[model samples]
Target: MTTTALHHRIDGPDGAPVLVLGPSLGTDLHLFDAQVDALADRYRIVRFDLPGHGQSPSPAGPYTMRGLADDVVALLDRLGMDRVHYAGVSIGGAIGQQVALDHPERVLSLAAMASAARFADPESWPKRAATVREKGPDAMVASRPGTWYVPSFSDTDEARRLLSMLRATTAEGYAGCCEAISGFDVRDRLAEVRVPVLAVAGAEDPATPPQMVRIIADSAAVGRFEVIEDAAHLLNVEQSEQVNGLLAEHLADAVAGSRHG
Candidate 1:
């Protein structure tokens, strides 16, 4: 395993097929614990805490999505991973999209989970941005529990644990992610992405919602969408079995696509 100043932690069997994972905003790499266990034997899974979250120290105000994309590239360079299969949820997805568009050769297959192609709604985001900046990631938690987990899942220990992670995020880091969200505009760049893409949407996802996820999946020329039943925003956590199965299938296709094209 390797650690960096950016606080990125990468593990799983070395020299196995690489899959770089980006977690949801407000939460850290723990969100991917279940996924790592499922695929670690066969894949070198790389997961990291974005700047200012988890072990990563907070950065000064206002970082753009492009800036976070640069951070991913830097992490890959540090790890000597020339190219990798990319998977991201929420803010991580947005960063992956930019990376694929801006640095195509570094990406093998791209999977975006509960993420948008662009900030579809502009008027509603500023207040959210302000909240994170002033009150920190914890402030966003009260309103997020139901939106992030399925109805039944919300009451479980796993849900509370995940919520704790989200609530623990620093204001600077969370706001930085929100800054990336606000500035993210990759609609025109989707056509430029030559990589195979998979969009995973939770059927009950309220944050990005199913319709919004569909629009993102449809926007890509070579993309498909998979819906996980009885899941919310955090589909990977709420519906582990279904999400893992879809990941296995989509990642295989992504690898095949890379070989052919």
Candidate 2:
């Protein structure tokens, strides 16, 4: 909701079609590190940390999903980018949907991973925010392993690294995002999205189930759904190869469709 500059990294070939990657709450741009490393050769990858997370400065108040979307559009404007393909996971995905709705002219396509049009059960978000606000990021980090990843992948080195990223985020930033998720609902507007959209879900993700993502795909004018096998919430990190492949294919398809249209 604040107009402060967000911490962003722009990489890949200059002048290549831009791909903007947003991060989930409790995480930062590192959420897309594997994707950026793999896709940078062919695309211009621009990723940013949420306000109050990573290197970005904290906002004065809590943020709305649409407000975060506006920050991205403003960032794109500052970078002289008029349009870019967008992708995000969890809260990041919610922001993507908002961008497609709030600033359709700025987005060429969308890839929403492990995200839903709305959180079907938002009852726990208040308590989550309160805990992080009182006890700090540790409270959220300690409670995320189960909801964030499946039990099997939760013990891996990469998983631990991601957990570390979560731990490093600011309590105020994480709490603000939890507040955003608590009241988020955009299902009625899903059909309003006109771009080619790809919705991805982790089969084992209890936080936002595949069915929730499917609603996004089913409601969009142009959309598709892909469920990463044996993965949980952070499917992009857990099944990087498969998730990256799906993104590559979707981006390619979107590009081709754009040219044809």
The prediction achieving the highest lDDT against the true structure is 2
Error of 1 at 8 (Å): 2.0
**Each model's RMSD to truth, in Å?**
2.8, 1.1
Model 1 lDDT tens row, 1-261 = 122256776677888889999988878988998898898887899898987778987767577888888888888898889999999999889889999988988998889999988755755566677887777777777887668887788789988888888878888777767776887888876888777788999898888887877766787778889888888999998888888888898888877777787
Estimate the lDDT of model 1: 0.82
CA error at residue 261 for candidate 2, angstroms: 2.2
Q: Candidate 2's error at 152, in angstroms? A: 1.5
Every model's TM-score = 0.94, 0.97
Candidate 2 residue 233 C-alpha distance from true site, Å = 0.3
- The residue pairs found clashing in candidate 1 are none
The TM-score of candidate 1 is 0.94
Stretches off by above 4 angstroms in model 1 are: 1-4
Model 2 lDDT tens row, 1-261: 667588999999998989999999888898899999889998999999997888998875477788888888989999999889999999999999999999998889999998988886687887888888889888767667767888887778988888888888888888888888878899898899999999999998988899998998999999999898788899999899999999999999988887898
lDDT of 1 at 40: 85
Per-residue lDDT value at 230 in model 2: 86
Estimate every model's Cα lDDT from 0 to 1. Answer: 0.82, 0.88
